[model samples]
Target: MTPEIVEISFKGNKRVPYFNPKEIKVKPGDWVIVEAEKGIDLGQVNKVGRLVALFEIKGDPKNIIRRAVDEDLAKLKENRKEEALAFTVAREKIKKHNLNMKLVDVEYQFDRN
Candidate 1:
């Protein structure tokens, strides 16, 4: 029997499998809150069921904390705004110092921890 796992996609094209111990009903394109290294994170559901089993899971998957709530979504939006501001600031600083670097993307952790 295959384990109940759901693939979640985060920023920076990062994807990871998370264990759905509670069997929370979720489908692709759904937003979910999941366990992060520190507090928690929000990601979009990419795949579920047998398709997820095809991927070689290396370690015990983290738990899907819950389906994203309204509060979580609000936080995500605020984080995006902060990320944009941070990106602009970083680009200005880099140009100020004339460093040979290119700014790509800026992301913020859900909990900001």
Candidate 2:
């Protein structure tokens, strides 16, 4: 049997391939939580199809962690709000400390460790 694969982009256009172990139905632009290198992460499905041969795959194939739920999206929004607040506070602290430094944009990580 041909193995199915899906392309999931973690950020921007950085798409990675994974094996669809269960073949849970999914479509492009679907928000899916995937097993990323740094634990589980949320990503968008870019493409879905089957590969010619199993050996044609590279590295270890990861399965979709699960389709994102309402709770997951809510948590993601809340985390984003908190991240913005933290960035603002960090900038303020730098000013208060009389430090001459310019702060840039902030990126939220998957595991945030």
Candidate 3:
């Protein structure tokens, strides 16, 4: 299937930034990858939409794209596993190294890809 170019927005402090899905292209029903603050995120397209032109934003909206595909979902799943593993390893390392810092809260994004 031909890949459809779309925009994926992520939550930010001031304004959300859009990501380009150059690695994979997807459809409304398929899962897609989105670059988030914490790490790569997985989401499905709920609607087919385009980026509205905003001169103040600067750059081209063409840089922002989104798509859905199976591989993207699989990769996201693997990334989650890896992230969990990394966290565990980090915790162990911290204890072993006796770091003074205390662990704070961990958050995960559930929507808006």
Candidate 4:
């Protein structure tokens, strides 16, 4: 299937990257990989349509890529599970090591490439 290359912006300040059509071939309900500042981000496609306009991109358009595939989705899910376990391990490690920093939150971004 052919995915469409699209621009993804975050926090109204940073533009993650461009996504090729091959990367976003899945339907609207499918989970796709969006380029993010930190890494590849996972998000469901909210809309899809034909390209109508082109504008000057802030960063290089070549940096943008595509959506995630089944393998990618699986890896992402596995990573999330691992991330949760890592958080627990980290908390325990912090307690054992007597670190001063407080664990407030944990965030994970997948498919950042």
Best by TM-score: 1
Summarize candidate 3's per-residue lDDT along 1-113 as a digit string, tens digits. 32334444432322332434364444444555555555455555433435322313445333323454567656656656665776787788889999987654233453322
How do the residues 11-95 of candidate 4 rate in per-residue lDDT, one tens digit apiece? 2233333546444355555555555566657665443445312444465443335555798878777767877787898899999
Give the candidates in order of lDDT, highest first: 1, 2, 4, 3
Ten contiguous residues with the weakest lDDT in model 4: 8-17
**Span of 10 residues, lowest total lDDT, candidate 3:** 8-17
The positional error of residue 99 in candidate 1, measured at the CA in angstroms, is 2.2
The lDDT for every candidate, in the order shown, is: 0.92, 0.74, 0.47, 0.55
Where does candidate 2 stray beyond 4 Å? 50-58, 92-104, 109-113
Q: Best lDDT goes to which candidate?
A: 1
Model 4 residue 98 lDDT score: 100
For candidate 3, give the lDDT. Answer: 0.47
User: Worst lDDT window (10 residues) for model 2?
Assistant: 49-58
List the candidate 4 regions with Cα displacement exceeding 4 Å: 1-28, 46-64, 111-113
Listed per candidate, the RMSD to the true structure in angstroms reads 1.6, 4.1, 7.6, 6.0
